[model samples]
Target: MMNMAQARPIAPNSPSQKQKLPAPRRGLHLSPHMVDVAVQVAVVAALAGIWEFGARFGALNPFLLPPLSVVLGRIWEDLIAGTVPVDLGLTLYRALLGFAIGAVIGIPAGILMARSNVVRWFLDPLVSIGFPMPKIAFLPIFILWFDIYDTSKIIMVAFSCFFPIVAATYAGCSSLDKWPIWSARSFGAGERELLWEVYLPMAMPQILTGLQVALPVGMITTIVTEMLMGGRGVGGAMIMAGRFADSVGVFAGIVQIIILGFVVVKSVEMIRRRILIWHPESRR
Candidate 1:
């Protein structure tokens, strides 16, 4: 045998005339997710630590700024013990019903305006005038018309949440990619089909954004109505606590309101993600 030559290793692909192996493309992984969760936990712990320190060391007065434990205890006593369930239930019921009512009118009204000059002309003045004014300003009118009852409160929330949604929906419809409409028309699509298949789907993101905005407004209006007029809800409880100067109870009510608000926001966000999973923000 001839003297053995040291073998040179050949690369999986040629060095000069190489076909790339894609550099081992990274897959979607959950490691970043775990890190994010850890970071969130740390943040919460830090905030809680600061709050505890402030409350315990007299940086804040116990009466004015009670410890989280005390506030939570009060929440347990009043809310978890059954005092809040009925009131919260009623408030939510009204809020849901009111939002549903607003959606029925606001969405269709917005579409009509976007699609028809006649509808826009009729509605423009009202929307412009009403959108900026606080719905609470109409509280007196609601009271007078519906009598300081659930009807008044429901109406108040419904109207408060309506315009923003209607406006957003209108914007969505008006801002559609014009080419799609032209194409659909050229392709012999009926007006109804075009509206249903093209406009509605394209407008869904804006429409949902409006609904998200409206949802919080609806809840807030309900609480404010309850607070101002006195009714069965966390807001009423807060008012009652203030009337009695029960600091712990007041704090508890405020906490409950905050928690409720958070839950509402989170729920909206979850629904938004599910519906608009294609949205970049939702995907992240």
Candidate 2:
């Protein structure tokens, strides 16, 4: 028989019998991302201030290194006149079009290479050779083949962006863990279902990273081609400004390029987050 004392229920308000639980601590918290953004803004502001002071006081050549104010004023004037917008639109169109083409080609090629030894063997050497060679060197050949119009420029941008996307995709595809594949197989998923539901989702983060890499390359290539070919782009505007020795115009063109690039990259990041909602890194 059990003792009455051992079997008795503890009184509800007895301090000695009750379990002690830790109270939840509450305090002010700051996000690391906020801190990072603050630091970056501070640094950029400091640099701009120094530059402005130098230019204003003639510590730097006003002709060669205009004040940030002068540059900003020129950018505003260009914006008001609609010149910047037209040039910016053309640049964006070419860059994005090239990027789209490259992405469509490169992603599938990368996946094929990852899945088939035959495809890998056939393409690996070409990728290896082309990846390191300066893509700009091929511009002359492309121009000769496709003429000095938008076609050549688009092709150049696509070529420059392709290697990065393919490399990133291939790396992502090959580096994927086998557990997801095994789990899908255990569930009796066929090859097509596994490709769509398992492998693609697992590879998506890396594929997005590849796209990110390719985007910047496409923009850069478009700018370089425009600068060389001299037509209908921010790069062409910059070239003309340089030719006229208009430092303010040159700087304004640069600012436009910076703005355009930032907007595009941020858009890509947003798309990446949406696509990778289930990914832990993407959430952060």
Query: Who wins the TM-score comparison?
Result: 2
Looking at model 2, the pairs that clash are: none
Model 2 global lDDT (CA atoms, 0 to 1): 0.91
lDDT digits (tens) for residues 192-250 of candidate 2: 99889987888998899889988998999999999999988999999998999888988
Whole-structure CA lDDT of model 1: 0.87
Instruction: Note the Cα lDDT for every prediction shown.
Output: 0.87, 0.91
Clashes in predicted model 1: 0
Native-to-model Cα distance after best TM-score fit, residue 5 in candidate 1, in Å: 6.5
lDDT of 1 by residue, 1-284 (tens): 55445465555667743654446778967788698878988998897777778998999898888888888887777665788788778878888889989998999999999999999999989999999997899999989988888999999989998899899999999999999999999999999999998999889899999999998899989888999999778788888889998888887877777778888888988888898887676757
